[model samples]
Target chain A: MSFVQNFPFFSIILAMFSGIVSSVLSGKKARNLSLAMIVVTTALSAGTLAFCLKTGESYTYMMGHFPAPWGNEIRAGVLEGVTAVLFGVVMFLSVAGGMTHTAEDVEDSKLNLFYIMIDLMLSSLLALVYTNDLFTAYVFVEINTIAGCGLIMIRQKGRSMSAAIRYMIMSQLGSGLFLIGLSLLYDVTGHLLMSPAKESVELLVDSGSYRLPLLVIMAVVSVGLAIKSGLYPFHYWIPDTYGYATPTGSAVLSGLVSKGYIFLLIKIFYRVIGYENLVGAQMINVLYLFGVAGMVMGSVHAIQETDTRRMIAYSSVAQIGYIYMGIGLGTTAGMVAAVFHIFSHSATKALLFISAVGLYEVSGDRKDFVSLRGAAYRNPLAGIGFAIGALSMVGFPMLSGFISKLLFATSAFDSPSKMLPTLFVLAVSTTLNAIYFLRLVITLYSRRREGDKPLPPNPVKKSSRGLKFAIVCFIGLNLVLGMASQPIVQAITDGLAMFE
Target chain B: MDVSLVEHLLLNIEETVSIVLFGIGFTILLLHRNLIKKIMGMNIMDTATYLFLASKGYITGRAVPIVVDGIQDVSAYINPVPSGLVLTGIVVSVSTTALMLALTIRLYERYHSLDLDEILILAKEEEQI
Candidate 1:
């Protein structure tokens, strides 16, 4: 095996190890160690991406001495490599950008615990991306959920504490459903490894045996993942969970954590149960229906939201709706668009959260629309960052959101039955997206009223060079995703082609 | 409704029982107003899943999975994978239960109520104040 092939395994193990080591260290040391580990993993994943692109194939690595059927395995392809790299970049930016808030919001004693959770969260995300074993994916899903709950409650407020419990309950319910579904799948297929299971599933489908069981399994697994990712009907916990957490927590949870679950669902659809079978089961129709509902209702909720952070959180519901809509289109091109939307949404949402923090800082840590007026004048970089993120989310030309939107529109033509509803929702959702995001932008830049009382003097004047750097990099990342989307989409197409 | 369906259900009594238990646990989880009861409901749901998995691994007149005295035949043992999965599921459930209980403790300290609705109201009142 080439040395580059070891990168995925090494990165996952390194992240888990660092998480363990950080638990006992001081808070500052843990933070530094976590940052260093993120940088190293990003480089490693970039190397893997380059190697995979050159090889133009997927390779599976055994976790131990045993081979695939009897042992755990992780597979890496163009899709996994690109996703890992994107996750690493987004995570680093989110953590670095929200560093000031982390220091202030979390108490001194439990700070190292925060870094520990972050490290574990990253490890879980990477494992979810590369895992070829269904059981291993379930284990990592639990890790991600627990660590995410810890991140929410680490801020040590009553609101955050309560939100954590609500999050935990919903998440546990999702996992329980997922576990039951997985057990049923294993019972039917007699294999836990994805490839072997896929073979068994194909045989069963061809023989027309176990049809009802197969359909039930697909619905159960899809609903489990949909609930976890906060698709329309089950997203009641999002506003409080995202709105009350620390800035980094909000960014990472909304940007990467939910996307991880969706990626796993995509893998299950393509790799485990074959997309054609899923379509036959009519699960895609259900997803498409919910996706359309979520698109309109999420935006409507956002319009009704009074708080700025909560508004952004509601927008996330809408963005997730768009991704599911793409997936529900049930074509290769549609899946490609869905995957690309994952990337664009991650970049733009993380940027918005981090920049919103900067705005909050200038406005004396209040997130209300009234207090945010003219706050951008004090922090021009943050103001500009917010503008770029908002505009990208609004699907402006030469922005990442626009590219994904275009991909969705073009791909919708492939399916005649889904075409009209897809286009109609696209038009309606885009208008709704514009109304809320642009309103926030205007609120940020609007001048303070002459009759309003003067704001309190700013307290701490610490230099936020790290925050500025992260914002600039995020903006650059968004632009690159928008302008150079062709290659990435091609990469995703190649990756999905190799998926089976 | 049909005789053959009843016969099949009876033959797979363990699976039927487990499914019924799962339904009960899920309903309790959804309907309970107290935080402790909700956690209890979650644990019950987890236990039902473990029961289901364990039933799948067991076979009639089969020995435990371990090899006994140079007997390496596959027929000598029940399927071992489901048992292993059940063990892992138990560990995860324990940890999740512990985490949920800890959060409940904190919430009680803050609101002095074990009822979710009461706590939510108290929290909103605190926010306004």
Candidate 2:
């Protein structure tokens, strides 16, 4: 009832409020305001996480004094709190990390618009993470999608325009399906909040009324989110969209944007549908099969890519596969692995994209892997950052990816029937990951052979000191996450235990 | 055995009609070749979805959800939640339509054509160059 209990409420409202203010300002002022807003959000969310840990209680804050059934609400548990902090950190770093790229890539006149869209996107991501009401989630999801399209086409270049169109078409289809699914759900349960919906769904299932329709809705919602998140079979728009966007766009779209939807999916499965019914509906099997296929096929596609950014995009599809595979395992530990992978993938991919921009600048602005022969020699900071990201992606020991992969493998162990196939695909994906990422690492460090294009007469200007500091933080976080896995994993498991 | 199912679904003309509209809109969005046509299809799909949702909240003879004095029975009013949701959906769809048109205009400016295949071919040709 006090001010502190409303941390989740104010955190979301503050971000959304900043987004509105951001739209009216010049680009420079907007960036300053956004930075201040993000820092405040990060601090507040971290406070919320600490408070939740101390109290060991999850509570819901109702909107505008309306009761739960009538008005919207936000649930603040340790899981939601931690995810909000992650969203803040990633958004903050993404803009800070690619500051120069944004300046260079966006038209000077339209820079204000870019910052506005980024702020809106951040607010939407935070809202998506915190909102307890399904309809609120849908509204923010659209806001996120529109802001995403703006980020992609801020260039107004031919390639980015085409990419934006494709991205919008695919995303619109996904949201449309999501809307239909939510309509069916509301019709069935007559409740929009997760707990009441879960109760109604359980009763409906128990009585076996319209069981087939319920099953179909589950599949529809699952596939809808899968498509939007660029999981396999729905990832056709990903490489073009990520590859063509500016570095900051690439980082935010691939890293932070995708995770919000995945977070929603996890919440849906764990809280709204009830995990028992979710597993019983056989949706996980479909997700499992596609995830395995994505693991292999995504890597293969990455290997064939000529451009570095597109390769990273394809690799993202593969990483998403690992996350989905964990979710589809249908165990609490598995869900933790999936969520852990979400964090690791987000941090590592954003770092990779920003570093790739640094590599591009010194390589005569060529994004091709061949042109990056001696990038490290010119800019050791980006080179080292890229190496850290590559190592993590390949699941080297003592990194975040390894822990997520290990959690995934161990989690699958509980289901003996699924153990071998899951382990096999994971093992194969690891090898495939090494093949592409190590090749790039070797290319970065490889000597500038004579026949290759000469290094630019002068090295491109080094990235701003702020960007370097964020990269250092990224490396340190990845290393610390790897070394200190026990507390975090235990925390994740504990947080998930309190879900719903 | 299936009599009740058919009556519940097929006899509900509003639901069936809206669903049919959704299917048609989806087909147009997916299979159409023109950029403007795709936007139209998207609008149609939005309309269909709103119709479906609005129809879901309807009652046979219920009044509007506004409460007048002495109307104490909850059953006297239709559900208002779906209409509220559909209003938000309409706003989102309108914004989407506007963005799509802007994008289409940009594409038309670049390639001088509205056909999606023609634009794709032009893009591929440009890439080769």
Candidate 3:
């Protein structure tokens, strides 16, 4: 019944090993090994998920069995359980989609490194989520960030190097500010453990001499995290990076890398500034301001974007806005909604990006709007998957986005401060989201003109059996998950109850 | 506020002045467009972060955070964790800077220019077509 005792963090260990092995293998062997690894890992992840769901135990893994508030601890509680399940799902799907590319696009020299970095990224992210120690979490963050850069730079062509460099530079700035925030926290309270750090800060706040230190630390850390989360005013790097990277790389980065930051943000906010203390509500306003700004700005920019990848990149910025909005509400429902949205957004967006891989492969890599005039007619499955992702993003009924946003809006109405403005902001942003994503959907779905020059024979082979089946699997999962949102919502609500 | 000796040491005039200068250098980094010059500014900023951490460790009579004085009774020395973290951070920053420089060289080879504006123009032109 004890999932942690049963799971033994084996998925993460296996992930790292598989990544290394996959990178080393080549030709038929590499493909077969990767497939086997994906199947085995997915089964292991599912076992972990089932055990957690059944027992509903908040499991804590103490590395070296050290006492917390002094030493490190990794907790596999409800939130961690949900995250693990999401990680498992993403890994399985990405690998399935990646099988298509491996047959043709992969360079034998780079394959080993690619698989290794992917595994390392997943394993480090798993570690980051489990650990409650502030310093340890930052270490994991750095590892994941660096590994992500490695994945992007593996391409070593186009703007990938520049994209990777920019990502690296920005991440360094974020890491520096994050460290400074930690330093400032250490000065105020000579502890690295999050719970005690919160206690010490609370004690100082009551004393009143070091209030500014708390504010400074909050500002620095928030800015640093905002850079990673691609929140407004710090989103300059995301579009270019996502646009330039390989499709698989972009999918994983968007799906998982940013989630690492969001996970840490939730932890820091919960552990260091407990929900009860945050009821004073200035942080809510800040979230609302930036959330709305990112939503509106990102959506508007996406509407004008001619490049499909760049447009999707912009849409991610806006989708993250919805998550931040949920956080701003600061209720149990809001937090739960935020977590649910994270799961749903990652799934749907990864599918959308993977679909683009199919299109790009066939069309010889044209990403601009004009080039995609007859794409929907050529690849109906991809066109349909993009539409579903777009619809979910716009919060259409029965889709995953609807459930999360409805909960978020309900929570926003109950917010203690500036409720009307918050509601207005979310509503306007949703409308804008529909406007842009619908445009993409409509363009892709409409019939091609008869007079249009016959599109050239696709450069790459039409979707192979394996690739087509993978796309179908994702589309099927998206539909089923949409129909089955209630249980997921209930699980999130149960998880958030701990914070309350 | 009940002031400690450590706090008084941290409030030193000369160190504070130099910290201010370091801040100015990093601020200049945000304004400049010359990639090489901006990198130099980043190094300046990196030095400031290191100084800040080291200054926090200073106490009037404390020795360096090492066992040089004696194996036993090391509590009187400056705290070592921040210094250790900073050491790693510095290495990371150096490697990142090196990588960025390499990328800049590649960009120059492609566009035959080092100026950000020129490269951006070329990129935009490509995108337009």
Candidate 4:
């Protein structure tokens, strides 16, 4: 294939190298270099997406030009195409937001390391999504985790340090379990590729001896990934880290990093396990149960949270649960809904985080609902962004979240199992979403008293080209893409067809 | 001496011993209270993985995985892939250990104790902020 064909992967490597070079440069120079890197990467990703659409053919690029099965391979099929596009969108938005906010926070002393780690994290994410080899996927997972940990700890703040340490411990445990599960498959099949190992496992499914090992392996793998993905019981660390990290860093984590593992989970459970196997067994039911539980539990917790970032973090857990439920439904429609939710959530959530930065920049403190009483009136652009994002998250019709919810609800009702309990929980949670998010929306848009605390000095000027471009581009996506939801849904359906 | 029988017995013994070692390490990791000891258990489990990988590539009377001039060639060499992977794994484990140690030191500095309970209390206090 031509270099253009492999541009996505190449762009990532170049970005990381550029970041490393920029890190060593002076602060002002580094800012310019990071902005340049962001532009180049955003262009490359957008170009690759365009190419994929033009070709309408799935492409696989093997590392070192080695063939598949023996060597690692990166496959960019329909699902990857849609995800890559969404990834690019979020990345552009994040970089845009960061270009202004981060340039000011990143001192010359720490600039190089930050850029390098960011590049590594981004590259690893791309690799994780594209690679078909489970072992190679694990390597990418490590790189992502380490880079993430490094990002969080770059500041020696007590909370950042502790949170980073906790994340590192949890990640290591998850990685170990994941590696063990991979080893079990490798032992049985002598192959590291996902497809063949899955096929070989199916042949041994009937053997009682393999059942325990398989269950153990699945438990290990699922729990590990669930922790990483912030599924219900494993989601404790998310708010702590996201709440403390600079807004830009949190955006990357919630928008891109978590999605990486989540995509892998959807692929593994639905594709590798065979939908028949999953639906026939109790696994699907179990998944649905956990998902609904997370939905209810997360929403309830979010309702109680007053911290803006913490509230968003809780909402993420609940949102992930929604994605889980769609996947658990184990139908073509369900997978489509899940992927749709992923795309919509990535856009809306990034929009929210970026807006949160804008609000933080203006008001200086993001601690409580009372502090943000007239924020909407203060910055109309950020106010509308927040409102649209909140409404979309609540799954209001004509918005992106509505489609995902409708698909999920339809899939649940259509299943032979007819999981009414999960359906009820989902409805309740959506209502609860209105309770929390609407509170913020109303608080922002409401009238302020005459004696209300005066607005804090706006530290961030709305002048950076990258930030303006990122926010405007994402908001445009929210408006334009929300109307054209069918094509995105169709893309997801095509991607999920592999699982079927 | 019954050389063939001895070799067979030793091979079985190696497998059994390595499995036992892994099990013990895991048990300690699950049951331990001290965080440092838990890390020690993790190291032990890693050592078992190293042993298992090396064992997978072993053969009776085989030469080490080395490339030399013409004389040392031919069919007497062991599989090099597992050994090579094990080396990579070792380096990764070392990095993990270093990070773990750094974290432990930081925890010590914060709470002035290695006890998880005290650390949990400190974490809770920090959380209320």
Candidate number achieving the greatest DockQ relative to the actual structure: 1
lDDT of 4 by residue, B9-103 (tens): 68678655665676676665555657687678777776776676677667778888676755566577987756766786677778777877787
Whose TM-score is greatest here? 1
Per-residue error (Å), model 4, residue A205: 3.9
- Model 3 clashing residue pairs (backbone): A23-A112
Q: List the DockQ of the predictions in order.
A: 0.74, 0.62, 0.33, 0.25
DockQ-based CAPRI category assigned to the predicted complex of candidate 3: acceptable
List model 3 lDDT by residue over A1-500, tens digit each: 35445453676667667766766576456545555665665565556556656777555566665686556666656667677667667766766675656434457676666766777787777777667678777777777877888877777564666677667667766776776677677767877777678888788767876766677777777767778878876787788788877777788888888887888888787778666555553665587678778878889888888888999999899888878777777677778778888888888888888887776655556776555665766788777777888888888877777776787777776775746776787788789888877877776666666675444565444766655665677777677667898887877766655433
Query: Candidate 1, residues A364-420: lDDT per residue as tens digits?
Result: 777888788887887888999999999998899999999999999999999999999
- Report model 3's chain A TM-score: 0.92
| Every model: iRMSD | 0.9, 1.2, 2.6, 2.5
Separate clash counts for every candidate: 0, 0, 1, 1
Stretches of candidate 4 above 4 Å error? A1-4, A45-55, A104-106, A206-209, A270-272, A449-469, A498-500, B1-63, B67-79, B103-129
What value of lDDT does candidate 4 attain over all alpha carbons?
A: 0.73
lDDT tens digits, residues A1-500, model 2?
65667777777778778778877787778878888888998888888888888888777888887887878888878888888888888888888887777888887777878888887888888888878889899999999999999999998677788889888988888888788888889988998888788889999989989798789779878887898899998899899899888888999999999899999988888778888898898889889888889999999999999888899999999998998898888788888999999999998998998888778778878877778988877789889999999999999899998899889999999878789999999999999999999999999999878787665566476668767877887887788778888877776777787776
TM per candidate comes to 0.98, 0.97, 0.89, 0.88
- Candidate closest to the true structure, highest lDDT: 1
Alpha-carbon local distance difference test for all models: 0.92, 0.86, 0.72, 0.73
Q: If you superpose only chain B onto the true chain B, what TM-score does each candidate give?
A: 0.95, 0.87, 0.76, 0.82
Docking class of 4: acceptable
